[model samples]
Structures are given as structure tokens and as C-alpha cells.
Target: MTLWPGLAADAAAQACPAGWPQWDAFARRHVQADGRVVDFSVPEQQSTSESQSYGMFFALAANDRARFAAIWRWSRDNLGAGSDKLPAWQWGRREGGSFGVIDPNAASDADLWFAYALLEAARLWQMPDYLKAGMALLGQVKAQEVRVMGDLGPMLLPGPVGFEAGRERWRLNPSYLPLPLLRRFAAVDPSGPWTAMVQGAARLATQSAPQGFAPDWVIYDAGKGFQPDSERSVLGSYDAIRVYLWAGVTNDGDPLVAAVRNALAPMTRAVVSYAAPPEKINTVTGAPEGRGPIGFSAALLPWLKATGAADALAAQEALVREKWQTWSRAAHPAGAAGDGEFNYYNSVLSLFGWGWLQGQYRFDAAGQVTPAWACAA
Candidate 1:
């Protein structure tokens, strides 16, 4: 699991500039000294592969190699990541009071992020070992999670198992497929199915949103194409929020950027009209359920800025700024986890959307990572 040899101290010495206050606050409050990101809001006090992967990305974005290595280490040592087997999705206190892995199942989104972060870290930090590790993980992803449907060419599954309902039917999560990650994978491994995944991802985003709102999940049949997930129905909520975030951060030079924005234009209009992102929505009718949590506004920042929704972006920005103080207070009243409006998932989202809006990081059309330090240098 130790990918780098004898470079631990050197990595710490090479820590990137500390200029991002938002990231600083996050690392202090969310991530522990051992590099595990805990979701204290959950009763289980769980740590997931998603949390680890996102922490790696944020660390890399901040140019903090030591923290990145620490996060990777904890994930590999605890969750068995950085190996042939996909990382376990959840680790927390169990029923009997022992702390360990709760679910052995893998999450494809976290896997993709792990690979993406590793590969980019190699490029940015000039660590070829990371490139090798990333490539190996990418191979596992292709073998275990990717499948060529009956007529759909190659598509990504939600995980390595349990997603295929039948030979002609499959369950898919639209939010799991981020276009930038697909593009970056294709660039690294031209022969891989990552290219086809880009197109398939576009189809999912557009077709699943029949009414300009992405759903949390969808079903893809042999001939019927994409359909609203029967179990989850057409509800667009937490998972779907990342759809807009991904689309917004995609480089404008990418061919599919315009198409994705156009397909999800209603969200832009809705946010503009309401001056806040809806927490939940019916994808079929484009009907909003209610005003989303403050994090929803934070999540929509990049999309709003990219789409030229100045007034809406400003409104949400103000809301996030105002609410973040309350959230921080509620989350840390006694210097401990609070049972208030504070949410770990929302905090993660805010870090991502708000950090990007603040120019902490950006992705090229090829999905290359560009830390603000790189630009400044």
C-alpha cells in the first residue's frame, strides 16, 4: 500500500502554498490527523471511499502531497484500496460496537475519483509511481465495472456487482459518470472504453433529463435507451446536484459542454426564477419540491457562473456565505459534531463548488488538473 518509497518527509516538505481558506477550514474540521474524513452527522460516524477520494482530489488541488499521501494511505490500509480489489464503500461503527467496514461493495464514482486523482498527482507532482498505480486501478475499473450492453456499446455500471437486472436491462446512476474524468481516462489510455463512456455519459445526462433535470438514477434497456429508474423514480436531489457541477466545470472547449448545458437549461432558469436551487425536483415535470439546503446553492455556483446567470449566482453566493457561518456554528458549537442543520455531505459539496468558484482548481478539456498554483507560477 505504500506506493512511494522514502519520500514521505520530502512530500511533506514540498507542501503546496496555503492560500485557500475554505480548503483550510475543511481540512481542519472534517479530516482527522490520520487523514480519514469522517461524516460525523451520520449515526455510524462513517467513512466512505467517496470521502477519501474527494479528500485526495482536494489535497491535490491544494498542492498538498503529504495530505494526499496520508489520505491514500488510510484508504488503502483501512478499506483495502490501491489494489486489485475495489475499495470497500463504507467503514464505521458496527451494531455490536466494533468499528470496521460496513459494506464490502464498491462505488464506481469513488473509484473513478481515486484513479483521476492519482493520475493527476503523478502529472502535477512528477511522481511516476502514481501514474502506474492509477493505471492499475483504471484497469480494475474497466474489467469489473464496465460492460458492453446488448446494443449500447460500452457503459459504466454503478459498481462491480448487482447493477445488471438482466441481459437486456441495467441500472445506471447518471451522476456517477463525470465527463471530465472520462475524458482524462481516454487521454491516458486511448484503447480503453473511456471514450465511449463520454458519449454514453452525454446520452444519460440528456435523455435521463427529458425535462431538463437530471435524475439520481436511471435504467437503460436494450432498445428503450434511458428510462427513469423505477425504484427511485424521476426524483432529482442530492445525487443529481453533482450533474450540474460536473457539467459546469467541464471546459467550454469540450464538444459536449454546450449540449449538456442546453439539455439542463431548465435548472438554470429555475434557479434564476427562484434565486435558490431546489432541494428536490421531479425530472418528468420539471417541478421543484422546495428550496434546497444551503449546500445546494453552493453546488450550483460553477454551473451558474458558467451559464452566465450572474444575478442567480450572486444570490446563491450570498446565501452560502451567510449560511456557512450558521452551519459552522451549528456544526461546532461545543467543538464537537452537532445535531443541527449542519450536514457533512453539504459541507463536501460546498468545498467543491465554492472552491472551484474561488479558482482553487480547474480542469482542461482533456480533463487535466490545473491547480491555481500552477496558473500563478
Candidate 2:
């Protein structure tokens, strides 16, 4: 999808500052030359619209305009398939044929990231095309993916299709709603449902976790309220971890900020009690499953700090730092796509959680990012 007209080749403008090299290293290791962020642990060497959207955000945060453009290009030409403004969620090697999008359904979280990153890139870098594209895609997301439940107000469906399990019910992913992004979207269009989504999102987090653990998926009963998705298992693991990370890093004073803190506060105790957050928790029962991996520690650092659990923050930071070394060793000569310890998802979480904690990026109340370089400037 080599459609971008061109970009200047100045290294200084194209790269993050020398001191902030982790993102650069991460791109080098995981992002392919074709602008695809490949998750190697998956046997198919799959790519997701979510990864592309995330890479765009990181590139914008690092001020790497070139990589951001390339990622956008690849996602549009490949996942978007040159037709849809919204890119398909998953792309990979098919069982019998060439590599391409396996499904055309747009994932709401990925679409949200794509729109948010594009608009923010426009603001941060003065790319008007990015802003225009972002607005267009945002409309598609709202038209095709967002819905108003019987009582839940406006809500983002997990995808454009297939989330409706049956009549009068829809499945929702809480982590899909980034509070800061919702605020930003509302800023873009005051009359948009984004603001209502902010309220609905807060309600989602607080109500879904009766026991203080967000579920990976919840069902809106139209009558009863948010309930656990038995198909996804009641356990909160990979998908739900990011909920805490996003909530913690959200700007203070957001309407949902207090709700996030209060709803997830038990995680602070979990970290202190176990020296690490549990790897899996039954969201309904609030029971521990196992000692969460190093990445879980990484994910909790910002949340721990946000909740004023200094000792817990310190413990997680220490564990996260130790795991960074493990990543280095696992990545040095052997490589980054390892088996158990430093996998693709773990690396991604570390980048977001640890990077936020270490001051690589911060989202303002309006969700405008003050990246590390911009901070110093």
C-alpha cells in the first residue's frame, strides 16, 4: 500500500530523541519493513488493525512522522483493502493462500485508536490530511459500530458485526473504551455520542466489576445490566489488563477518573498481597488464579502510582525493570519473539505501561499527548 506521496528524509525529524530509544528499538524488533507490526508468537505471523493503530500512536508520540505514515499506509492498503475507511481487525497467512485480511469486520477499539491517532497526529504534527481522514473514519465507526442500548446510553460495540449474541443483547468490551479518547472525540464534535460514551464507559467499568475486576467481555441484557460472557470465560486476563493501564494513565479530573480509581482499587491490595497482580482473576468471584507475569507487574506500575500505593508501585516498577532485562536477554542474540516470558503481548504492554510510567508519553485531560520530546521542548 505504498500510497503516501512522500516525506522528508531528515533523521532528526524522523526519529525520537537519542535518550528515548526504547520505542525505536521496539519498532526495529517488531515492526516489519512493510509497516506491518507482526505478532510472531502466533503461528500465522498475524497482523491486526489494533497493532497498526497502536504503532501509529507510538510513532506519533515519538515524533516519527515517517513510520506513522507508513503504518497508516499499510493498514489502509492492506487491512482497509483500499475500500473501507475502517480497517479490518485481523490479517494473516490464510490456511491455503496469500496473506491478507482474514476478516473484514472492523474492531471498535482498533478503529478508535486509528481515528484518535490520526487526529492527534494532525494536531501534534500539523498533518491536515490525517485530521480529515480521522474525521471520516470516526463517522464510519459511529455509524457502523456504535449503538445505544436500552439503558446503557451510547456504547461502542466490540466490532462492527457479530457482537450481538442474540436479540435484545450485545456484547461489549470495557477495555475498548479509552476514557481519554472519548473525551477527545467529544471535543472534536460536541454533539457526538462520544460524550455519552464517556459516561457509559464509566458505568461499564464500575458496574461490570461488582468485585473490582473488569471482565474481558460483558453482555448487555437490555433488562438486567452488564453480565459476564460465558463464551469468553469469566476470567479477566489479557484483554482486561489494559483497562487498568488506560484508566491509570488517563488525566486526573476526568469524570470517570474517580470511578476508575475506586473500581480498580482492589488491584492495589492484590499487588501488595501477592507481590504481583494475579495472572487471571475470576471477575465475578474476585478470586485469584495465579501470579501474573512480569508484564502484569509492568501494567500495574502506573495504576499503583495513581492510587498512591507507593510501596506497591515500587515493587511493580522493580519487577518491571527486572523483566526489561529479561526482554533484553531474550532479545539480544536469541530474538524478541520468545515463548513464555517476553512475548509480543507482554512486550506491547511493557511499552505502554512502563513507557507511560517512565514519562515517554502522557495524555492531557482532553487526550492531547505531551510526548517526552515535546515535554522537554
Q: Who wins the lDDT comparison?
A: 1
Per-candidate TM-score against the hidden true structure: 0.92, 0.92
Poorly placed runs, candidate 2 (over 4 Å): 1-18, 81-85, 329-340
Count of steric clashes across candidates, in order: 0, 0
**TM-score for predicted model 2 compared with the true structure:** 0.92
Q: For residues 104-167, what per-residue lDDT tens digits would candidate 2 score against the true structure?
A: 7888899999999999998888889999989889988888888889888889998877899778
Clashing pairs in 1: none
- Residues 1-377 of candidate 1: C-alpha lDDT, one tens digit per residue: 12111124332212333488667667876788788888878788889999999999999988888889999989988998888798999999999999999999999999999999999999999999999989998998998999898666899999988898766889988889888999999999999999988998898888889889999988999888887786757899999999999998787778988899999999999998887889899987888999988778898998998898888888898888888776655436222553344467787888789877766777778888778677545
